[model samples]
Target: MADSAESAAVPIISTSTSTSIANVAASPAEDEAIPVQRKSSSPVTDPGTSPGQAAPINSAHEQSEQEDSDDDSALGAGSILSETTSLADEITQYRYEHNRRYHAYKDGEYWGPNDDKQNNQLDIAHHLYLLTLEGRLHLAPIGDNPQNVLDVGTGTGIWAIDFADQYPSAQVIGFDLSPIQPMWVAPNVRFEINDACDPDWGYKKNSFDFIHVRAMYGSVADWPAFYRQALAHLAPGGWFQQIEMSVVPTSDDGTVTEGSIFDMWGKISLEAGDKFGKDLRIHEQIKGYLDDAGFEEVVEKVYKWPIGPWDEDIHMKQIGLWNQLHWEEGIEGWSLALLTRVLGWSYTEVQAYLGKMRTGIRDRKVHAYHIINVVYGRKPIPS
Candidate 1:
């Protein structure tokens, strides 16, 4: 990874751009691998909408149905399609025939098995290496001479690199679905391209002092199995941290406007998950899974992030901006995966419906906001 690249699509970090991009500074390793911010290739593509208005998935009955089921289960029989080596080989064949398409791999564009991101968004998001720095969130209690950390779903390999730099004696490993991680990492920091969800991946049990996962909202259909695997593999006194979002649905004063924007968002996003066997409600049930897996000292911190630059406070305002960008980009990103690909909807139709969603978010009468929640736990010292 380079320190920077010419600004490409969605350069949120550029001063020339209208928005601010969150960047974290680490060590020399970071300058090369973790903190390198760059532009993404390929402009956001427009997915089309339904030519005729169809009955949207009914939310009234869906809510009742959602209340009765537990989304957690052990990994059952499944194919290894998600972790296939050559995305172009299988994914291209599948998408060309099935209308499935992934964003071009230029900078940090890997979703499942594609390697792209030369940028370092993943590193800054973790911010775990900044524990010693003033005012940054880092999971501690690694003991005085801690070493050996593992980051699951390490998007850009930033977290692992920074952690290795912070603990010079520690060996850090980061794993993801693609080979996008930079080839040159810290001497102690290594990157592996593998699906963490795979049950048979070769790894010694009870290793690693810390394990981290973030933003796995819909990508993980079975979180319980995911958590169970973490518990089973975690060494004594190991820690696991998970961060997720509320999927952009909230009620201000508990009175939703008629035809509120977020109502449309909730319908589309959740229904998209429904069609794909993904779980948007995974955030709500994390605590249950952690406790059931026999983990101790479980902690859950939920933050109600503003939707846009609405709040009077400046920090809250920026968070609102991040929220807005996340919402807009998220719709485009997921549509490429779910609606256009899995749902087999036309690109034009998805674009038009998304425009309606954007309109809803801009409407103040809608009175909606969303939140990001984080949950973490530690394995007790073995008896």
Candidate 2:
């Protein structure tokens, strides 16, 4: 088993662009399998707007719906309009690779699955994120209200919609590479199918008071450029918060073994991300990137998210259960493409490998947990 210290040293891609492309510095065995970061061959496509507007899914009556019920249904399924709304604005046709689906616009741009299963997993993960943070949508000190806000790579538009509801006066825009977000939303909130990698962003310069990016690790091709765009668009004194999960799981008590399947999954996934031009293991470098981007007062908070119901604290135990489900439900969707398409493994091989990874995830004795980093900084105010 590759231990945490050994795994942290391996570079997942060529370091031509940035030295921070390494996943973990694992032992020679792991390092030999993965190398430094390099540019991905897959081209990013323009994320188009939905075909047309539809009614928002969370209607007034739906407000009475319990949080538990919300957690049960897929992100957009609870709405009466889900059936029509999802298909209404078909900006790009669905494309498939290795029996799994990918967005057609930028064929191989996003390596993650976008089908119903993946969508539900994203929503469930959102629930877990909220639970872990004690229901605070963001840690940025935006105060009572802000006029303009942006949510980059807003999957299913859950966070944006919730933010809009929390601050009725603020206008929130949710941007993503897929048209998966529902058509209708809070009047102040709107969903746009667009790519964050584009250079000529349509927004006015320094117009947004807040920008929120969550779990967009595998999609962004250039971290420096992404932060530059955030800095450019943010209003003076505006806040930018990036929330991400580490691909590598850690054990504080030295329980998770080295060379574990979970570690291999992280290695292979990070390598796949390199092949596709995005690095999955860049969470640790976000703070420096923000600082280099000229942001001020940067702050980073890391949380230990357990993999199973193993923690003694009731809250942590519950978070672990949800986190476990989050991984269990999406494991295949997350691994199928990278393992088969990029790594050139047979489907059977991929499944066999995942079975082992799932076992590691479920074993409470492993004491396995991934770190969630929430880093936020303010766009420096003019002197």
**Which one is best on TM-score?**
2
After TM-score superposition, what is the CA distance of residue 269 in candidate 1 from its true location, in Å? 1.5
Among all windows of 10 consecutive residues in model 1, the one with the lowest summed lDDT is 1-10
Error of model 1, residue 74, in angstroms = 38
Provide backbone clash counts, one per model: 10, 25
Error (Å) of candidate 2 at residue 301 is 0.3
Q: Per-residue CA lDDT of candidate 1, range 323-354, in tens?
A: 45445545555454566655677878877888
Tell me the lDDT of model 2 at 333.
85
Q: For model 2, how does the per-residue alpha-carbon lDDT over 1-383 read when each residue is reduced to its tens digit?
A: 12233221122322212112122122222112122222111222222443232323232223345436756477564564774556544446777766777775556667788777788788777776666555677878999978888899887777887787778667788877787776655466777767788874567678789999999888787889989989998989999999899888777778866777766767778788888678887788899999999999898877777787677665566667777877887889877877777778899998888889888887878888888888899998888
Every model's TM-score: 0.67, 0.76
lDDT of 2 at 197: 82
